[model samples]
Target: MDAGLLAWGRAVKRRGGKIPPLWYFTDAARLADPLPVIRRLPRGLCGVVFRHDTAPGRLALGRRIAALCRERRLYLVVAGDARLAATLHAGLHLRGGRRGVLRLPCLVTASVHNAVELARARRAGAMLLFISPVNATKSHAGAQVLGAAGWRRLARLAPRGHRAALGGIDGRSIRALGQGCAAAGAIEAFYFNV
Candidate 1:
């Protein structure tokens, strides 16, 4: 199978109307035993996103994650490094910078928190768009939250089929988005906070 298609197919399968539970581990220490937690997740647990935090052995750990995903038939997303993603088997998720990178037609995702960012993601031709701050986040204390209604509205502004919710998302809220999600076409995934 095509590596890119396989990755995208897995993404769609995980997110398609099912409102899969996604866990993003921004903490560096979690990588030591992420697989054990990942393997035990229910069907809703689709995958994980590894954020950049100046940790050690990230590349090696990311490579290990790629191996786990390949072995388990699960998905692994690497944020902020298109080159690294392209090199590894895991999918690429672009959050901030988008220059000097060649589009690989892989399951590429971008962060879109507002109308301007959404438009920029569309222009960048991202396969999936991640909209965040849907609820008040403990990590980002005092940050504005988009809430459900705001998320739906922002998603509508994006291109026809390309949007996913992020930031302050929990299992319960994800269930709600799965039920009456407004961005019907674009929201193929929910990168939730687990």
Candidate 2:
């Protein structure tokens, strides 16, 4: 982890919140094997958003990751599958604008690209909102970049301490956001060293 990110996580911890300050979002295409990366995550203060979407043996992978998360005391959330998340006893991360009801007790988060999606996420009772494309990223090539200003504007729409800056985010970019979000999510940033 970057020094800035570690510091940010520590700060968030000091503030007494359940949300982790740093997050790792998995991409099957970008990172075929994420166990090593998950092992490298700082204990207790970081979260992992397990997003293998279409990979075969996803449940097996989720179980492995869940075990690792529990051992490390890190938060874990499965992307787009409520049943899978429930089975793993982890949280659920809904994609942009998908309002999936949760009947079980677990953390519910959502990704929002715009104000409309943000409102919908809030309505769905998302405990956290990941505002994406804060900077140029290869993951979503040609997608509109929010930049620093746009990120701040959208982040303000969400209640304080419930927002996370995602997409092309790094330690430097997180600093530039000026504490705009309570947490920060990244794919490349965490995988670079792996």
TM-score of candidate 1 on Cα atoms, chains taken together: 0.71
Deviation from native of the Cα of residue 127 in model 2, angstroms:
1.1
* lDDT tens readout by residue for model 1, 7-34: 4434555555432324344444433445
lDDT of each: 0.56, 0.86
Mark the regions of model 1 whose C-alpha exceeds 4 Å error after superposition.
1-26, 29-33, 42-45, 96-100, 159-161, 175-194
Per-candidate TM equals 0.71, 0.95
Please, what are the lDDT tens digits per residue for candidate 2 over residues 29-61? Answer: 988889999999888788999999898999899
